[model samples]
Target: MNLKETQKKFHKTLSEIYPKSEIDTFFYWIVEDVLQLKRIDVSLNPDFEINEKDLKTIKSQMNRLQQNEPIQYILGHTEFYGMHFQVNPNVLIPRPETEDLVNWIVSDLKHQPKKHLLDIGTGSGRIAIALKKELPKCEISAFDISETALQMASENAKQNEVKINFVQQDILKLDSLPEDVDIMVSNPPYVRVLEKEQMCDNVLKFEPHQALFVKNNDALVFYRKIIELAITSSKCKTVYFEINQYLKEDLKKLIQPYDINKIEFRKDFRGNERMLKLLID
Candidate 1:
């Protein structure tokens, strides 16, 4: 199949499940990965021929996407905060909102002295790895409960040429992090179980549920535990979290014990409160 033929097939087949805009994104992502070509190449050489083996692989991936698999998983990796990460069914694909959380932390610490960093429930090590890339002098450690997820995260760290200590420990059970950790970040499982209906079939079917969900009645469970640990640990000067968009007021009340002036809720570009920054005395 030629480039034009492959493009036509992708549009025709994927349009059944994804919108035209999303289909364009999926096509470009697959083209760059499979063909070692840029988006410009699709138009520059519409007649370029795809080898038989590569065509078969592309068609196989199209079949998977047709079956509701995420294109990131089909590609076996994804980009986050300008860095690529190896992903699988064991970890949740890093989202743009989480990138924002990472940016907030990096912006605040980019010029500061070296500090110890800890990321809880660091699926795919996206946050931890990105932080290490941006803050090369900082010591970074990331933990996840799943060995499969931790393995994928370690691979990503190596591929990115960043050093991150990946640990297989459940955040729900771990009461404290290492001392001297001046900054702590977590994008824990904050999506409530009841909110599953609001998600797309591809995410619900393909993403790792353990990394995406928390109990409906206890939506802030992870936040609560992590904050308590930060407070008790006494070494965490600042805490950053990718929070549930719907729990703004609940989070404000939950952290009441901390100085209100130091607790700030930041909204995502969508205008919902999606992150929190807490400074401890």
Candidate 2:
């Protein structure tokens, strides 16, 4: 069938599962990835025909999307911080809010001298790699419990042409970082188990749970450990976290006993308290 016919069939088949706008997005993304045609090309060349092999691949991806799989996983890559990143089930897809977190770090440290930075639970290496790209003079290291995630992060680092020291170590078990750093940043698993219902099926079904969830009673477990480690590590001058909005007060209480120079909370585009920065003296 032609591209227009394929588009209609794709929308009709998945209409119940996704909205028209989302379906349109998925269609264009698939078209560009599979057919090597831009969205404007599709509109300009309405009669464009996709070959049989390409048609089969498109249908297979549609089947997966019908099952609520994320388009990022289907495409095997996603745009984050204006760069392309490879993603899979082993690593969480990078989100726009995390971009805000990265910008926050860049704004704070851009004028400072070269320093070391550590990204805890750096799945897909988005935060670490982006910072390395932004602050080319700084040394960056990232660690994760999952070997597969670290592997993908390493690949992404290489793809982005940014060097990052990727290590496989669980933050929960680390009493201190392996290396001293001026900035310690993490967008750890802050989603509580009870909040699963609020997430869409695409995320719950396809994304790695290890990178997205925390127990209800210990929602801030990763934060707690990372903070303790940062506070104890003399060289870690600052700590950054992409946090759950509901637990802002809890996070403040968690850091209450620590010696900190300043604490700032910033909201995402949604106006939710999604980023936190703590300056440790």
Candidate 3:
């Protein structure tokens, strides 16, 4: 069928699940990814006919979308920090707010001498690889407890053409931070179980839960461990985290015991407290 007709049916099938604008985005994203046609092409060629095989593929993806699967996972890739990274159920999809956290680190370290950076719980390796791309002289190492996540992260690093040391280790069990790491960054699981009602099904149902949630009573578990490790690291000078907006005060109290010289919180585009910077003394 024609692109316009297919999109109309797509919208109809998903109207009960997603809003009109989101359906439009999902349709166009699939078109661009599967059909190799740009949005403008679809607009100018409204009658553009999709082949039967491709149509079946598009319909299959629409079914998954109807089931509340994230489009990124359906497409097997996503764009972050101006680069594309492969994604799957193994890692959480990188969010735009996390880009702000990456920007904060890049802005501060861009002119500094070469430093080693470690990304704890580096899911898809978005933060570490982006930093290495922007600051080529810097060495980067990323570790996650899930071997599948580490494999995906390693592939993403290769796809981005950046060299990053990918390791498999649970952050909660690590004894010490890497000796040469000068800066550490993470967007670890900070969502409390109680907050699940506030999230969308596409996230809660499709994204890896272990990479997005913590126990309700211990929302700061990862932060607590990382901060304790960072403060004791001889070469680590600074740390950055993409945090949950609701836990800013809790995070503040959690960091109070660390030998920190400065602590700053930056809001994301939505004006929520989402990023944190800690300069270790």
Root-mean-square deviation of every model: 1.5, 1.0, 1.0
Q: Per-residue lDDT of 1-281 in model 1, one digit per residue for the tens?
A: 89998989999998879899998888888889988989998889999999999999889998999999999889998889888888888999888888789889989999999999999998889999999999999999998999998888999999999999888898878867788788889998888898999999889999989889888888889888888878787678788998888888899889987643498888887787898998877
Segments of candidate 2 deviating more than 4 angstroms: none
Task: Work out the TM-score per prediction.
Answer: 0.95, 0.98, 0.98
Per-residue error for 175 in candidate 3, Å, reads 1.0
- Please report, as a residue range, the 10-residue window in candidate 3 with the lowest summed lDDT: 250-259
Residue 56 C-alpha lDDT in model 2: 98
Residue 190 in candidate 2, Cα distance off native in Å: 0.9
lDDT of 1 at 91: 93
**lDDT (Cα) of model 2:** 0.92
lDDT-superior candidate, 1 or 3: 3
TM-score of 3: 0.98
In what order do the candidates fall by lDDT, top score first?
3, 2, 1
- Cα error, candidate 1, residue 134 (Å): 1.0
Model 1 TM-score relative to the real fold: 0.95
